[model samples]
Target: MLTSAILAETGHAAPTVPGLASVIPFVILLLCIAILPLIHKTSHWWEHNKNKLIVALSLGLVTIAYYQMRGYGIAHGDHATDPGIRTVLTVLDHAILGEFIPFISLLFSLYVISGGIRVKGDIPAHPITNTVFLAIGGLLASFIGTTGASMLLIRPVLRTNSERKHVVHTVIFFIFIVSNIGGCLLPIGDPPLFLGYLKGVPFLWTFKLWKEWAFCLVVLLVIYYAWDTIAYKKESKQDVTLDETRVTPIGIDGKINFLWLAGVVFVTGTMDPTKPFLGTGWTPFPFLRELLQTAFVGLSLVSTGKGVRAANHFSYTAILEVACLFIGIFICMQAPIEILNLKGASLGVDTPYKFFWATGALSSFLDNAPTYVVFFETANALTHEPGPGILQLLSGHFIREDLLIAISLGAVFMGANTYIGNGPNFMVKSIAEHAKIKMPSFFGYMGYSVCILIPVFCAVMFLFL
Candidate 1:
């Protein structure tokens, strides 16, 4: 490839292909996956033990950090001589990950929810309330981003069903509908789709996802209704009596900084490759732009500290964990990304369906934003297509709306396929577990997704995407 060829000419050690470089991180990840099940199998250390998992996770993180730091200098060692790493890193930096901001925003919203006041029990339980909340949650996820909506609502959703002995299905359904599948209507709804829009795919182009969104939404709603009905029937059958007198509504205990949280969503959603409203022959406020985003996240965290002994303590934990894990994944995955881009044309994938599933399946685990770009750029680079049309330039001459739609829908919709498919999926599961929801394990989660999401996704691929 040109990158490797250029590296050889630059008098630097040529970069190895990603397939080879990926061995170590993949191995480490596999080991983690294997060990987690063992940890879960032992009765001594329950999966619900957040603090214990935190301790173990912290130790693992320290070790990974040590090795990563040792390799860090060498990561860019050839930068001066060869620009390959720099080129790849420059293109794949934090800004690329920003495509998943909606997912991140979802987490921020969740953190805000955790500090709310504890309501007294004995309140009347209304199934309609759960339905309404989930509906509102889906709408909010689209607008504010999925992560934002999930974080804000998950705690309350859990609290509403907290007393119920059977609620794992509720949390699972939430992750499926609210956390992942709901963000399909607009670019702002999800990061991967947003990245596509920023790269020249139109903002309104995402409406193509409506069909898939409707399908998933209907299926999930039906599942929820059925499960809730059975659970409700059981409660009735058992004649379970709640102490209504003891029930109380929990008010917002901490400072209800709704506006600050809104600011975070705005900055995270609007800051993009498109650089909205950047230039209009008017003086641009570059410094102000940076400040607003910084202040938005900073002020949001600061606001979270007002009622607590330690400020920014809880706010930082989830964000910091996401930061660390994603950082490692991003940095280590660079080689693979570069290679993917370099060899994209030769992959023999040229159909809309192939591109859809190819990009999506990768997006399921890989960072979807970059995955979208790589596939889009690959499709674009397919032909030295003659004329200068934006559509032609983008899709390398065969830029049909249907093709674009497939790519868009696949990248956005299939992201719900696994816990790691999108940022908030795992975060929601983690937080739900933290709230003691008894969520499934990584592979266990996959089983649920495969059985439910896969069939529906294939149906969409056949019918729409």
Candidate 2:
């Protein structure tokens, strides 16, 4: 049984004892994402069957709803004539209204606004120059989102490295630093941290993580520089004429989009549950922050010139794919979230190390936003914090600060463990693939993470956690 705090935070009443059957849908979805690509080599089966995958996952939603209604009816006498219909509506409302709309809207706005900006240049792709570009991307990701940063910078990086034979490593490292670890220091940086802000964590509290962020950034950058230097040498040996083209100065187009980008950041940063824009008397539908962001997206579309978009080769394919896949992901993820909410307290996670690994392991596969909330609630249960407030305020004395730090680093850093671990990862991959970079398949990419990122994370846990 979940506590009242858990129920209020999760927005779901306690169901019957969640059995193994309850988690099957989530398991099946993960397996399909991981395995289907490996099985169908040389065929577009995975791409073609995306609709089928969504429908299949929806069956899991229906199953969970049926069981939830049955459990509710048994526990508290049958009050409604049709519990099944009511349960379905409740699940749909929570999944779609409570989660999906805000998530997709933010991503859509960032994608559209960033896609409009075009950085035009014929920069030479030297090892040192490439390193600087990635460093800039890491810094940019903390202001704009990982999705926005990746979309904005990937094209220029790709164009710079257009003549290089060994280009895959550069993009992989870009995903590591820019798409994942770089967003650790601010709520506006990553989806998981933004969720923390919405749930009462202060906006600047994440800045305390600068030490961890700097440590990972320095280590990864040094490693990337060495690796890229070696690859560049190999390519140079093969083709001696690669250095004939001189570097050109970079210029910007659609500079107005930067203003809209700042608007997106300001809107997200100002969202506060304590002071709803529409007053507490009215039901908060889209919330003021999201509405403001959607407006910014509309403004960017009309304000940016067509020439800028043409230079950028901007298209809607990446955002559309994210929208389609994430809708089903949010729906199918409810069961796992419910199970975690019910059972997390009993999981023996009393220490910082335990919380770090547990939160990170699940975040490597599940969406990190809800995963952060689950562990946040679990930590809150330990402290018995009276109500929702900033963790800095509420848990300062009662909760272990090291444990909170562990959860924060784990959720943010370990998202690099897989492509699906973070939102920008797949979008970056899709864009790189469209540009003719032969990105590794799902498992192949995990092989890189395990070999490279896992050891670095272990060192972080030892030194920091």
Candidate 3:
């Protein structure tokens, strides 16, 4: 299910769905990502972004070529276009150009601008201090976005716990709280919610999800507090002392970037071409938002004080890796996306709980934004003219309220289930790894999510979802 703009650009309502076999490139790329880093032979080879790019783009382009051969990329043709640019690559690249560039642009600007503003100085590494810090991050996330908040605060969190021997759990929980679950409160907080807003769900209608958002946030924060207390007790006496005494008065550097950060939020929240948001009217150019965001990136780069990023030891490698990997993931995953678009309603997901888990399960792997859209459309399809169990929304969509809430919570919260579940998850992990932290492998991380997040989500399911 491409967006209306994409469908309009393609001049086609429905392209032929790729066969299930077309999912092979995506699955192969995912397996390579999961297993390659653990293998002795490939571990070193996968370290360089160049090598990663080779595998990523090779598989991505192969899928593109396959789609072309299948004539899915051509304008109503039945064969692949020869060499040069895949010239009439309409719907496929149209979707890519529409989403991918903006996706990368938003991340790039947030990352670069946040990198310039250093949150220097370490406070006590006590569990309470870290808990409060994470809670602050959770609050910031909804306003500044999970990606923005993660980029801004991750270094501070790492620095606060620099002396602790048991800091891995803190980072993992950071991914849980700050990077994923915390962003459920508002549209600007996560991509899926923003997509919902663009689809004509009222901007503040999501504010009603405060219950589910608070439930998950409080649960995760409580778990993190308990977990950190236990780990703190187990730390060596010397390490604990260093944590307590090595603290410096916390302060902000490169404060001007706050203005730039606000600019990003404004652009993201109001630049929707589908809506006349803030009286901007309909934008004819799809990439205008991205262009403005890139402008912010350029401004931050030139205006930031020399060596401000030195405090955080910032690098572009994390953002570069995300760009490389998600381009492939986004393109190759289209087969499965189209599959879900076609078959989602037949999956026996009729109730609220079913919608929650179904949307969430796919969001855990396929990236949440499109998954939410598919399920949203599926739920919409169920409401042909208002039947039993159907409820009109405040935003005026007739999608059952319970199902919309479930889908919203599922897409926003369950994105923490894996490294690739959300963009910021990988960025957080990458930054942690660069700081010399031994972050868990892909499956290793899911082990944490399964044992911890699953139970919390289950409680949420019964009590609220």
Q: TM per model?
A: 0.74, 0.88, 0.91
Q: Put down candidate 2 lDDT per residue, 303-398, tens digits, no spaces.
A: 998878878778877776666666667777776776787778898987888998899998988878778888987887687453453254422433
Give candidate 3 regions above 4 Å deviation. Answer: 1-17, 71-88, 280-284, 385-397
lDDT of 3 by residue, 190-223 (tens): 9898888777666787888888778888888898
lDDT for residue 120 in candidate 2, whole number 0-100:
82
List the RMSD of every prediction in angstroms: 6.4, 4.7, 3.6
Computed on alpha carbons, the lDDT of every model, listed in order, comes to: 0.59, 0.76, 0.83
Cand. 3 Cα-lDDT: 0.83
lDDT of 1 by residue, 355-412 (tens): 8888888877775666777887777665453444325422224455555666666777
Which segments of model 1 are wrong by more than 4 Å? 1-17, 21-23, 30-34, 40-128, 235-240, 243-258, 265-279, 282-291, 301-316, 383-398
User: What lDDT is reached at residue 301 by model 2?
Assistant: 89
The C-alpha local distance difference test score for the whole of candidate 2 amounts to: 0.76
Task: Tell me which of candidates 2 and 3 scores higher on TM-score.
Answer: 3
Shift of residue 178 alpha carbon in model 3, Å: 0.4
The best candidate by lDDT is 3
Local error of candidate 2 at residue 299 (angstroms): 1.0
Residue 31 CA error for candidate 3 (Å)?
0.7
How far does residue 30 in candidate 3 sit from its true spot (Å)? 0.8
lDDT head-to-head 1 vs 3, winner: 3
